[model samples]
Target: MALTIAGCTAPPVVAPPEPPSAPNTSADLSGIKSYLLEKTGQLKQATRALKETSDRYYALAKEANFDYTALFATQKDEVIGLIQTAREQWMVASPLYEQMEGIVAGTPSLAEFDMIMDAGASKEEDPQDPAPIDVTLPDGRVLERPGNLFGVTESTLWGTFEAFRVPGQFDFNGDGQIAFGESLPDANVLKGGVDALDEQAGELAEAARAWTPTESDAFTALVVMVPTMSEYFDSWKNSRFVSGEASTQRDFVAISRLADIQDILSSLLVVHDNISPMIRGVDTAQDDAIRRGLRDLKAFVAGVHKQESGGKRFKPEEADVLGKEAQDRADAITGQIAQMAARLGVKIEQ
Candidate 1:
């Protein structure tokens, strides 16, 4: 009836509809979440160690009736030992935080801790970007937004700020000469600062556990974090690590800023790796170029680190040159990521 010698209108022949294809879900960023949690757990453990050692120090000081001189006179080795232990814990906690900072600083909900822990200046130092928390000591002395926890602890332990130090210098190391960080820290201040840091670290760890990362977070982290080389280099230029004995900075003396830069970039690299598939899906050539550029940037920093390890102290002037070069590379890479994010409709959080 449908093909009646072309004299009648042909009945329509309909093909069945095909099933819908599955969603791409190309960027499975669960690894980023896992990485953050794993590192946060490790950071919490390190902070706990610092807290324990700090408490032990404070307990000994209390036993000495708040006389640090008396405490050091009678228990020099224990005091030094506790201080060293706290320092070791700080070393661990710092890099662990750096490893998580790409995610932490990029996410809106997680960004405050980055301010309180790492990048925020003191109210006095930078009212615009000051860390808004204050520390209270046992003696009722209040540090009015004295800076980021890391800065507070570092300055307190190193005796860079006079208010955070005990009355006089001590040859705690028995080297016959008092060097940097050789003086007795005011125990009350030490305990307060480290305790605050430990508390905040614990909070950050919990927050990180609760955070579910998205492609936005990964891409935003790359865009927001990858171009920070200039600031880090400025810190390195001003720090004693590069400025030598003439440096007057209160913080960043205990560790090289170069090392910190590498740690931070290493975290951003993790963020990129987790989202590379999405980038590749959008533009394979661009993804490969970004990957290569990032690796090269990191390798450039690594080259500087290797030189530092070999005792090649970079002049402060040289840091400017290096910083500019690194920043240029970083800016280029970030631009690619930003363009790709736009193409993929990934919203980079402001």
Candidate 2:
């Protein structure tokens, strides 16, 4: 045969095998649905507490003819306690509400949810700026509201309203300084805010119960949420927290924002745990990376609590380093999550 070969045999021309497709990790839709339901229940309970407390305060204020001094004399401690309770409940409910947005994106109710619960305007210099409180529904019906419930309530409770400047209005803490724990100057406005919050809470609960998340929706929720953690941290770094605006008084803004970020990260971890098996199957190293990143970010946040200046909160200069570190760690976690999403063939929407 060798002798008979007249020319060199041509090399076998085999088409290159198509590259293997990335592994598709099945989304934990059941887990997402259950978690959303659980959070919805918690939100309902928390909002109920808020509404009840607010109602009691409003009733007492009404009985007193909105006389702050009279109300303070009679039920100062009770009013203060209710305000504190409402604020605490709000803190718990707010983050869960945020998580629900990601889980229920692309649904019909999302627009309504945003309209009712959006916190974008909460931190504005003047959250009470007059705007159209009427919303045009999908059916073209007008839905009138007094104002944004959370923002209005926060402004009133925190004494950001001009009316709060009235002397002898709310001095619950007796420090002579009207601060967050004080009562609202106008009982009517506070009542309106409470009613709106209660209504919105009902709507949210209804929407959550009706929601049915698909596997794709679960994946979207996981992918979309990772980057939001950075947004929270960035807000802290670029806002009053870094510019020394929060150094003077007991600025709860920074603390509130930090707590919000922590809540978001913790929620993401819950979702991660729900899909841990799939993530492990795709790449254990990436999973480990994400876990480590989250741990580091949490540790950094914890360190910040120990760095408080003037026994109020960490000063701008003191927080600068830790804030940057937190942002970096959040970015790392986001990157790892993005990689995992890509491997799972989940398209992440901006």
Candidate 3:
């Protein structure tokens, strides 16, 4: 509407105000913290199981005077049981960790444990994120940041590391033939690594208890952790699950990298879901796009996992192609998210 003022002036038109995008008061991240703590609690249980099994293996070795040949000859059944139990515990604990990685790895205050637990590479590999501790073996050999606790324990249990192997083949599954990673491991190495991992799991849970989750932490997790496709795909390409016998990798063999990637993305999806109301205020269209994008990314990996489960081994080159496609998708989605964060005046940690 226009109005005349003082018999000659006309009032100008006014545009509608832009909608506010204040942080949603309901965007409480205490749920995420609760989920993290719950998972860590379960992880503690699983690692304790590993610790107990490793202790048994250690005690058995000690009983036989640390002689691998004598231990295996007399206590074959016991050794087999301990190895199987340890493997089962690993399967449980690793996924529990993965279920909470979005929170743990995204928060700067707690990212180091991710390296110590799963993501770090070996001393020889000199991984970009190396496990930050040097492990001193019982025999006086120091493993200088020899990798993640999961990897060290897995390699030892599965006989993947030459230094940790028992130097004799045994059909652990009673299949009457030797399979890959079917032999015994060094007792001291297994016990030491598992014990360290168990302790760290407790420490992580303690830190989580002391820490609080903020909108900043949630957003930072999404922005920082969600676009890591190429690195994950490279690992999948080199793993035994994707490369079969040609794979020279060790740790990820116990569980397929594809499975791990899917689990990780699943957790990230939960993180995004929690802050979705805040994102919607900033831009409804973008909020929906990010949501759909996350589902699509997980589905893409799920397709590959289905094929792998059906016994289709992907060549290394093929994995690179798939990885690039996923990377491009992730880049686009995160780009939209980064823009939204800036517009909302939210600070995202790089």
Candidate 4:
């Protein structure tokens, strides 16, 4: 019996099973994290490139010393280029972004919320030119300056660029009524792009909460600053305008109407900071509400039918003084914003 059992056991000796393989962390996240990190780098590079191009354009524009509206055609081309470049880059980057989302979706790195708000791809520049400026003194000394317009006009053209013009795309068709194109939302769609960047920054911020500072911190700061810049530029462009009538006609109103305009511009400068901070971080339901409130305030100030405040008419003499004061305030505001932007690595003309 012992001899039979020994022979049977010798016939079926099996090797111990091999130990299970360890999971490969690097192999599991092969393309996605890499894609996200790469795309993020592209965005950073594009931002810097766009800023440089914009600065160059602005320098050339300032040297021209032309009216605000005069360079509309040139600016249109410049802005269009900017948009095209950005679009191409984004097109390439979107997939990477999607990949990032996929990798982060079921993982520990998942964001509370993430979205990418794309602006209309077909952005174009508006044909905003300078209108004539003519003012007459009480003694009838005419001061006539051609193409001295504000906002999207020639005089403010450079300043507008300094404030809002990006390096490439310029199609302003988003303001459906302002430019030629198919139907769209309000002319304020440009603001949405700015808002989108801010939103991305917040997501990046959340990512940073669990990640390290050296990598995510700079990117988030860059993202947040983009909207801040766009807001400044958009406000500047929308606030000023040039004359439609001849100097002879404009002068009569200058004695009567210029003061009101000065007040409007000054008011814009005052509220700039208030509106900017709200949009500087992220776009949310709350931010939208704030935006609506700000818009209401703007409309209220802009829609004042009467020149009188506190039951007193702004007499021509008093209006002139007020105009001067407003101008001084505007200068101060512009100077301060310029300094702050520079400190933040934004390039604005002196």
Candidate 5:
């Protein structure tokens, strides 16, 4: 009887088969092109706005007899507002410029646009009264211009040029130190910096309008850009925003750096979203991983803020941690994107 019962034991109920995964779809190339065009248009507009604001600042400076104290006393609000506006525009353009680097690299015409617009330091043997570089135009004409635009403007605004040991030059005040909250550089000096920025902005806009990106170039952009971003964050963390001689005294420029990071991530997200369909079509698992990684990186970047004590500044230790985390995340994203590029049979150059 026991044997009969054992043999009669009912077969285990079979579970229903799992559902098949959805088919992946490739992204429309037209959509990506449209996004690029739209972003470039925005960048052009922002740069133009920045130029106009700078022009207004220059005009005000001219009227104020180039005296920092008199300028602040008479048109403090207007001057400060213009500077803030120009800074905001720059914050918007910086990331767009980075995003466009790969495309620019692919286009010979845009080769020197970045250096012209945002050279970090003047390429002169002497910081004061530095000679202008000669840039050959498309028509084979030479245009002489200062190497530093944004950098010079920033230095003037923060009164940090004295750190360069160029005494009595950018030192608007008689004090030995060019500390934060000190008097700004003379109106003429700031006006010249603003003029350079204005000219370069115009050139950038013209270049952006003429440039176009191929599919291969777009893929290369994704591959190259992420790693470049990691490098930028690493530099910022290690030196640009840190304490000691590397930084702008104790000013840190934390807000500016954070804003730039935010803009950069936003631009990268546009590229990611546009290319996501292609990634999904090639490999759904990889696509998911890339999206997740970018999302995490964005959240981490957004969370970063200046920790001020007495005033706005960054502690070296704290900046180092933040910078390391940002760099690591950027590197991870770059690797993940490169995987997608590989799957798509795109060759990314070193």
Candidate 6:
């Protein structure tokens, strides 16, 4: 009987039930982490896409001889809209992902959650150019050229429009003010009128040369002429039916003039983007160095643009000063651009 009692089986070993799963707790937290990282990457890609698209649109607008401000404005709105949409989606998804992580780890306080997820939103609208409108003629077809500059001035086409509006008689008859009449005179007479026109054009050109844009309004008007100056080169080059080669004997003149205006515009835009980064504490000493380099480059390009175009008639001694200034600026900017390009892996000709 003792032996039988000893043989009795021991009580079955008890196993505890598995612990309850925490709400949204990932085993390794890798899933949620990966998702947040991917979302951030997507946001950056969207920003890059927006920039590429904008650059293309701007380049095309400039090529078409469109009004720069209006062209820029049109592209800017589209870019801003795209950025807003991407940001909204990123903001919504990012915080939610972080929240899930917090829940899985431990219940985080609201303030702590905000601290982890909050990069406060910034609100500002991008400035841009307005949509372009085509100018239609009597036959409902767009006019390729409006002789005497009537069609250009009639529309919002950019340039020194005031030149077209001056009151003057076509001949010695001393008629009343010559308004921008609807129709051009017959082409047969056009050749005969060249001498008088040449004289008038010379006077107008002298006025353009002498005019110094002193006030903001005058500067704006001058700035607006930049695209037209560039377009003059295009028109001279492309019109095969016209005397293209003879027209561009002074081709460099047009390029130099347009370059000056573009240099100014580039400087203004750069100051807004890169220079401000240095000033705002967004970046530090390296940024300050880059900013100084950019400033020097900008000044040089401005001088080159002015001198090349013969925009300002400088004395020989002044020309040397201007030349040195331009060279210095160009060198500085080229160096800065090279440094930046190396960091970003961008390839551009100096």
Whole-model Cα lDDT of every candidate shown, in order: 0.85, 0.60, 0.85, 0.33, 0.58, 0.32
Q: What tens digits encode model 1's per-residue C-alpha lDDT throughout 58-169?
A: 8898888888887888888988888887777888888888878878887888999988988788998897779978888877889888999998988888788888888865
TM-scores for all candidates? 0.92, 0.71, 0.90, 0.27, 0.67, 0.26
Steric clash pairs (candidate 6): 70-129, 72-129, 73-128, 73-129, 74-129
Tens digits of per-residue lDDT, candidate 5, 1-350, equal 99998899888999999998755544555654565566566666766776677667767766765565666766767766766666667666556655554444333455465555543335443465333444332224443443445555556555566532123332224466755434444445555555555666666666565655455655666666555545555555554545546664322242445655555566556667777777887687887887787777767766664333234456766666777887787788788888777767766654
Better of 1 and 4 by lDDT: 1
In angstroms, the error of model 6 at 259 is 9.9
Pull out the clashing pairs in model 2: none
Candidate 4: C-alpha RMSD to true structure equals: 22.0
lDDT of 5 at 237: 58
Pairs in clash, predicted candidate 3: none
| lDDT score of residue 234 within candidate 3 | 93
Q: Cα lDDT of model 4 overall?
A: 0.33
The regions of model 2 sitting more than 4 angstroms off are: 1-24, 73-85, 88-115, 122-148, 163-169, 173-180, 183-185, 234-255, 306-312
TM-score between candidate 2 and the true structure: 0.71
Question: Residue 102 lDDT in model 6?
Answer: 20
Model 4: worst 10 consecutive residues (lDDT sum): 180-189
lDDT by residue (246-318, candidate 4, tens digit) is 1212111211132233332332322332334423433234334433443443343344324333343333344
Over 1-350, each residue of candidate 3 has an lDDT whose tens digit, in order, gives: 33454666667989989997654634767778788888899999999988988888888998888888878778888888888888888899988898888778888889999888888887678856578987776667777888988889888887778887788767766778989978888888888888889999999999989988788888898888889989899998988877788878887888888888888888888888888888886578889999999999999999998998898878889999999999998999889878877877778976
Residues 197-313, candidate 6, lDDT per residue (tens digit)? Answer: 223223333432333322221112212221222233233233221232333221121123224334343423322243233222333454466556545545554555456356443
Task: For candidate 5, give the lDDT.
Answer: 0.58
Model 2, 1-350: lDDT tens digits are 77568567778899999999866466555676677678778777877777777778777776777677777788878777766776676666666665555554323334345545543332233355433254332223443543455656655555555542235556666788855445453555555665666677777777767777654454455556555645555455554445444432222342356655565556566666766677787898888887777667766665554453334555555556666666667667777777777877766554
